[model samples]
Target chain A: MELTGAEIVCESLLKEGADVVFGLPGGAVLPLYGALSVYPAIRHILVRHEQAAAMAADGYSRATGKVGVCIATSGPGATNMVTGIAAAQMDSVAVVAITGQVPRPAIGSDAFQETDVTGVTLPITKHNMLVMDVKDVAQAIHDAFHIARTGRPGPVLVDIPRDVLLGDKTEFVWPSEPKLPGYKIPTVAPEAQVAAAADLINQAERPIIMSGHGVLISHAYGLMTDLAEKAQIPVITTLLGISAIPSSHELNLGMSGMHGMAYANLAIDEADLIIGLGMRFDDRVTGRISAFAPNAKFIHVDIDASEVDKNIKATVGMVGDLKAVLGQLLPKVEANVHIDWLQHINELKAQHPSHLVRESDELLPQYVLQRLTEVTQGRGIVVTGVGMHQMWAAQHCRFTEPNTFITSGGLGTMGFEVPAALGAQVGRPDVTVWSIAGDGGFQMTMCDIATAVEAHADVKFAILNNNSLGLVHQLQELFFDKEYIASQYTANPDFVKIAEAYGIRGIRVTRKDQVLDAVQQAMETAGPVIVDFMVKEDEGLYPFIPSGQSVKEMLEEPTLKEIT
Target chain B: MVQSNHTEQHTLIALVEDKPGVLTRVASMFRRRGFNIASLAVGNSEQPGLSRMTFVVNGDDHTVSQVAKQLDKLIDVIEVSDITNKSTVTRELALIKVKTNQMTRGEIIQIVNLFRANIIDVGSESMVIEITGEEDKINALHNLLSSFGVIEMLRTGLVAMVRGQTNGLANGHSEQVNSSSNS
Candidate 1:
């Protein structure tokens, strides 16, 4: 079948099963957008900012495990997507960002809207290509999707020159198979590593399983839970590893790190055999590398080999798909009782419990999260921006399924929740979608409200307007001698008015009594709705152990008795 | 997770038809599959057309062999070989600028002379030292120079080639055929 290069691009996308693309049109991308008109099956979302388009795609990919697609024009459009692409790379989200570039001849001459987007995005993307030849367009798109969707998935940019889009391409041959030499997906877990891991699990007196985002990405949650339960091992999660095991599970010890649960951190410190699953020991988790579980014999399992010894030393390092490694080790692992370890963990949990007391007039963020969790029954998708709100959501919101809760864990990118929620809603329209963002982070991508309004995406955004960078302010108050620096942002916009500007339903909740009613009203609305909850500015997240410190060293709750 | 201490080193150089993501795919392969790469370097080759990549990695002999075999399977890669012990010429270049005042200048000069490194650029307060050798040699120099205050350091990671009268491209074809037949 003979098709133009632009048609071939769209056709290849359809072939790869892309249901939607987030983008905006410009002179360079007119032909591709024109070609997209013919394909009614694929929905195209026009985001206000090119950055949001890339972020929306990232969110879509993270939620659905599909290649999230985004399109933008040349120059500024391409540059705008860099931050989003970098965020995806950092967190390992599968995304294919397609940008239209000037013709081949004008690439270096700085012609109208001309930019070497491939060069600009080189370091940020997993891989990138600039297509000058019409024949290579189809193959490039095919290869882009393949590269984006496979092993340690990340963003791949394909910059299509404007002239190439206008050219006539008759030979439309998608590569029968992607011939990437260095892209091998290791299918088997090394038997020796698996056996060694099983032996360590069997012999360990104080065993702790530290789960990370890789477990969810590899779909090893069930296997992990089974192993933890059967072996009677306590499980602690990284911020990204939340929902890997149900928060309600007895073995689940919530989160560990700077703002992690006291018990979780304590367990990690005291553990003799630390089995790290699908997680890189970032500074947040390890606090002080030298002092972090100094006595523990570490068993690190992750798909990324580079991460094995890059951080903490591992006694048993297995590099393969977490799902496969856990599968192989599951049967060989003997069922044993770590009753003493469990008792110690329980004691720690009792010592420091997350307690939030809502006043009669003050709208607490925890209450909103708890109510949302109740209404959703942990069945729908919940996304959050980076801040105190995110920690609250992670602590309070119970996610029962994989891919149900998406947040920027590695990069901790703020302004991620709204667009991510939009993408999640688009990907899974049948399920309820909730975006929880702090006042500070919410304003970063607040424009995405228009994206929701335009697509009529059924998403509910809960803006916890504490009127400050709550996380930073909390740290300053606790550790920085109460000197707020770059944490306070006064004179904020009326969120209700902003939502109204986007043609979406908006409500403001100042009192605790109005919190549930506002949320319920937003949920009942058919399309996108935003409920701005005026939370307490002085409110702080609790159970925060200073970084590099032991879990036992955490401040159980706010020191101010009045706030409590 | 079981940690295997048997860190087998293999040096692989691939001659690829210059294209994008050929490196990413290769790096992604090692990264995603958890192949321990000791050192990796990629740049334009002598051949007017192709790019050469050198990868120093630690894996089982079978796995390293499989990686070479797999490289041959890639359409863009012209050749790949484990050049760890194949009589290869290996070298690495590093430019390290040290922060030194009058007090530390004599000590820095002494360290540089002991390492047989050349001083590329000399400032009133600093000196840029150029050193080329194996990775360990560079590390040793870096360690000794750290006390004198290293202001900046840039290493052009290891680039290698077979020393004998043989080209990787020629051997690549036979291995490709052998692997295809084996498959």
Candidate 2:
């Protein structure tokens, strides 16, 4: 039973059923790497950069609903994971990050490869610990995983010193459970509160249920659908909440917010009763707080009480697990219908249809996404980096299952698609995973193409090669009078050639006829493949709501009649 | 989100595990949320291996409640109570140094007697008076001593307890608010 700190780390991870970890080795973590070699069944994907390691773990967690694990050395290796950790925290993904630290004796001396990573990551993580004693390694890892996977799941860090890994010896005994008295999450809402919410839902004529990531997190999609169908109410999903209910379902209105569907925003504004389930009223979703859903009486239900009334005031706030609350509410909610309200929503959708991206000779991003929809048959998991391509994917791709549409909505982190797709593919090897990224974001983490090739992760990359930062350029065109300063990249590398250099198949398509064939080729290829679609540079996301503006002030592309 | 009339002061008491880096976690939570802490006092509590912290916050109700819930989310924090609206006996101790002259010496003593303060230390031209009372009383004493040309002052923030055995530390403001609204 006697084991070194390094052995305890691996043993505890194995005990928690973590079979895969994404990491890179360094001088400070050599002991851990040695211990890792003993466990041949545990897979470790060697990432090109520490940031990709953290992001890959995040993607794995989101895909599998298990705590994703990543490892790094101290100093630069640990600091480089900050962006990815912050992304996981923002998205509320369960990730446990383990970093090597300097020996306890030399910790404050600013020794080589020494950094206060616990202090540095405190604000970004849900919880973090610096383990100084050797006996605490197993318990620390146990506690870290428990905290990461529990209430309002987020990233947690455990920094272990080198001396503890190398010098100290202790019996590795896994505690029965975490001895955390302060860690508790309420599971049930009060009966009266649930009754009040049900009463409001039963009485209202026009009601809409706004779903966020919590729906997916709690695995309450079935209950959510039951409630929506039982009540005959419409559901508008947030950007991250894309697949909470099937898009094909008659009740599901598309994405809501800045780049969301115009009809969805209109429905929310027109609703008389708004039941906010597991979704925060982010500023992006609610354009102007005072004017957002001006007519709605809100009922907010979330596990996190702090989120209740943090953005918009709720008439009745029910704080508990979404699944449990919905369970208690499903019976109390009477089966009803709003035929007039549904007809009105249909009218709104008919009136403000999104402007289609026209195809001339060059490839349009939307056209490619539409083609992807056709090719995947709404069966593939689509991951996206932030920008025009993300919005385009949200608009075009058909997500039918929960956790199928993965993207960084809260942090809006760029360069997320490549690593996230790889992690998702690794987590769910049976499914087809695609990374839809813009040219700028593709270049940011394109170095990870080598990582994909090494792991033989079957992930397809569709780079919307617009040769410009399309979203930022569009912002400049709208606000700065088209003075593109730092937004545009003058010289760009050939992405197809870059992927081919990493022993991955690559293809480039320019004309309209070459789009579907190229996409089909990437899908049928054996290993990782990249299809660089030479898209138009000036295609702006239309029906835009400018920052700090109300939903009523959205600008839409004029049709020929309006133009005349 | 109810907007307050103005920036109102709130007193929050929290019981946390006596663990290393616990204070930093609490302080960092407040800083990240952009809620300013006017005063903070930390010491061992009645329970073993636990510390009690009382901090004064000035912000709208939305931000203050946010801080309280976020503090509750920390692993080291066992419970948090916003006793600003509750019936409690709150006390703060302060030491004020007043520059005493021939004409103001008697006047300062009379004022100190009125305030029921003690002369803790006496220098050649200055006397340090120590006082312990509610926040308003301390503020009043400080205001009166300032007329005698005060040199320095230090205050321990407000620490409070419920007047009776109502167990204010057992549950947070949310539970109390829920019960009060029902009645």
Candidate 3:
């Protein structure tokens, strides 16, 4: 059928099962917006800033495990989306970002709203294409979705010139399948490697399973827990892998890394065998390579082969979908209980007990998160911004299910929660989405509160207001002799007032007694509600390993300091 | 002199689907990883709609293996083979223009004849000589011609194929694991 390049884009999105698109329109993307008006199948969320558009798309993908779509104009608009794109790339979220470029003839000439977006996004994206021809647009979109959702998922960009979007009528040819001859996705992992991993698990007296975000992407939550339970092994998770198993499970040791539960870090250090599923051992997770799990024999299972030995060595590396690998491995593993190991871990847990909220009249961030969990019945899909607030939310979450905990783990972008919550709310409309953010980060992307209102995205934003970049302030307090710089906010704005101006219900709570009530009100009322909790400014976070230090260097309290 | 973290050099052959900016993609991967390519040559392959690239990568065995693994991971690159250990015939072509007066012209011709090189073009003060062989032969010719006041030189980097009927790219990209010494 004859179609304009813009129409072909919509058609391709329809084919790819993409129903929501977070986007912002500008000069170059006018044709796309014009086409979008007529295409009612796709619901377009108009965000205030292009960064939110990309981030929201990333959030949507993380929440629903589908390829999220975002669109923007070229030049400044496209450049602004780079951070969000990088966030997705780092975490391996599947996002298809579309940007408008100048006309084909004006591409190299630096015309109005012109940008070499593909070039800029090349290294960050799983793949990218700049379609010079109108006929190539549909295929490009199809290929993008295919590439983004495949093994080791990541963001992909498709740049279409403005003239091409407004190109003359051309016959739209939808390919039967993605025309990628070179793209080879690994299916079933090598049987020998799977057997090898199983052999390690069966024989180990002290073993732990470290689950990563790949578990969620592969929908291996139940299988992962099954393997753990059958082997009677304790499971610890990467930050993004927080919800892979129910927090209350006997074998679930919770988040294990910097800012992880003390017992989990101790277990990783002492374990004889580590079966790593769908996770790369990032620097933050593995402090000092020389000292990280020195006694642990690693069996690394992931979808991407390159990540196997990129960090810590893998005695057995299985490159396949996590769920499939788990299915293959579950049968070979022998059922055994490491009673002594579990008892030793319990001793560590008692010694460094994951610090709980103490008696305080002042509203603590950890207390705020605990109340949120209690009030929401632990069902709220919590999207967190970076800082002390994020760690509290992660530590306090009663994750009964996977895909409920979404945050910027890889890039650690501060202003992530607000837009990401809107995206998550959009992705899963039936559930209540909570954007639990620290005040310092909340202000950076608060403009998107308008987008949340307009889109009717029902997200509850709980602002943990400490009047400063609490994490940075804590770092400065520990390392720089309390000589703070650029971290503390001299005059922070009234977040509730900002919310009220945007025509959303705003509640301010500074006392511990008011947290549950505010959380309840936000969850119940719900088009979009903002609750700014004035938390205790000096509340210390524990179980922190200084940068590049090993798990052995983990500090149980904030007493450790460096003169530098 | 080319500096590398690893002393050994490896030759790798990659078969990639011809696409725009694909060369940039491959080059960008090397640049970002801090890998130095000693030599590279790309041209259309025997297979239609595909391009064959021969790369002389300078690194240790593990680093070169990683380089090959990373290349195979690229969506455009279909296959990558470490042809360093294989029995292969390599060729490189170089064109040299040297300053030559009437007195030095015959001497230049004599030297070119000794190397079985052709004098492709002759001008009043310069002559362009064409030589095709392995990299060492071309380098030797260029060094010898440099004493006659070489004006310009261009070299097509290394290209190779297995000596017999075997294909250089074995399509065993997936089976190859990163052989890091530490790992």
Computed on C-alphas against the true complex, the DockQ of each candidate is 0.09, 0.38, 0.30
Per DockQ, what order, best first? 2, 3, 1
Which tens-of-lDDT digit does each residue in A167-258 have in candidate 2? 86899899877866677777899999999999999999999999999999999899999999998999998888888898789998878788
User: Candidate 1: where is the Cα deviation over 4 Å?
Assistant: A355-361, A547-553, A559-564, B1-17, B20-51, B54-183
Better of 2 and 3 by DockQ: 2
lDDT of 2 by residue, B28-63 (tens): 988877779999999997767778899899987878
Deviating ranges (above 4 Å) for candidate 3: A558-564, B1-6, B99-111, B123-125, B145-149, B172-183
lDDT of 3 at B100: 97
The 10-residue segment of model 2 chain A with minimum total lDDT is: A555-564
> Residue by residue across A1-564, what tens digits does model 1's lDDT show?
888888888889989999899998898988999999999888999998888898889888877888899999999998888888888888888899999988777778979988778777766777788887898888888878887776667899999988798776677887776655434455556899889989999999999999998888888999999999999998888888888888678898888887777667777788899999989898888877777886699999977665776577678888788888898999999998888889877776666555333443566778878877877778888999898899888778887877888888777889989888898888888888999999898889988888888888898898888889999898898789999899888889998888888888889988867766777787788898888888877877876768667555667665323221
DockQ of prediction 1: 0.09
Each candidate's root-mean-square deviation in Å?
8.6, 3.5, 4.5
Name the regions of candidate 2 deviating beyond 4 angstroms: A355-361, A559-564, B101-103, B172-183
What TM-score should be assigned to candidate 1? 0.81
Kept native contacts, fraction for each prediction: 0.05, 0.51, 0.36
Flag clash pairs in model 2.
A313-B1
lDDT of each: 0.81, 0.88, 0.87
